[model samples]
Target: MREVFPDAGFREPVEAAEIVEAERRLGQALPTDLRQLLLESNGVLGRTRVATVWAVDQIVEQNLRFWSDENFAQLYMPFDALMFFGDNGGGDQFAFVQKPQRPDVFVWEHESDSRR
Candidate 1:
């Protein structure tokens, strides 16, 4: 993180207990790397002070809303396969593919509801 944005901002690490509760409530384990990152720093702020990696609470809330909210469901394709963790400081969000749990990350564009 420091290497990428020498001045990037970071928050205090979160407890393992929080991670455990997050997984339990979300019904899935977070990606191992992401889990470790959150334990080291709850979130990372990159260019323009945007959340390059969101806080654990934000991750849970966003994912839950994307997966279960009626409005999102009606507007976009099912989001259960993705585990969102960041954004581009714009409307584009970053996520991990969770259905088969691949190592590659994907970008979800809010405007078009497209993933790439």
Candidate 2:
């Protein structure tokens, strides 16, 4: 990940407790690798040339905002099933599907209102 985003800047490391609390509040467990990344650095700053990974708090805030939007919520029902982690410099977002088995990562584009 670092090699792909050499210019990425990171926030101070976050506590495991914080990550756990975030998961609890969201009513879902985050992916293991993402949880580990948050413990290392809250999130990445600067441009990754892909997306800027949002800090834990930002993650919650953004998710809440999206979940509250009628249009978005309706379009993406069961929004809780997806955990948003980052965003393209534009309005697109990145997330992981919370399934029992492998959690596949996907990109949600605001322009298209579609996930890929």
Candidate 3:
């Protein structure tokens, strides 16, 4: 993960480890760049078309842009996060999604989808 984000600095290395461990616990392997981008940053960045899962008040908000159309939304059991499942082309393109569902979850609407 460090190799993936050489310049993304964090206040503490332990926090980065925590993020990696959290990903492992969730059973969701994030794209290296995106994961590194998120993990390395203190919070969401601004003005990018790419969707993000913002950390807000004990919950996370997600916005998805650019995912395989074949992949349908499904509940990622136990983790309480939505996931897209499909077998098709792979690209740097990703459908940004968030985790830890709640009424206050991050998003303009309760849910949304878009292509990057």
User: What local lDDT does model 3 show for residue 82?
Assistant: 36
- Writing each residue's lDDT as its tens digit, candidate 2 over 41-65 gives 8888766444378889988788777
Q: Which one wins on TM-score?
A: 1
Per-prediction CA RMSD (Å): 0.9, 2.4, 12.0
What candidate 2 gets wrong by more than 4 Å, as runs, is 48-51, 74-78
Residue 88 C-alpha lDDT in model 3: 17
| Order of quality (TM-score) | 1, 2, 3
Q: TM-scores of all models?
A: 0.95, 0.83, 0.33
Best by lDDT: 1
The residue-by-residue lDDT of candidate 1 on 1-116, one tens digit each, is 68767978999999999999999989999999899999999999986899989999999999998898999889999999999999989889999999989988999999999999
Alpha-carbon local distance difference test for all models: 0.94, 0.78, 0.33
Task: Count clashing pairs, candidate 2.
Answer: 0
Runs off by more than 4 Å, candidate 3: 1-14, 45-53, 56-116
Q: Give residue 12's error in model 3 in angstroms.
A: 9.1
lDDT of 1: 0.94
Better of 1 and 3 by lDDT: 1
Worst 10 residues of 2 by lDDT: 72-81
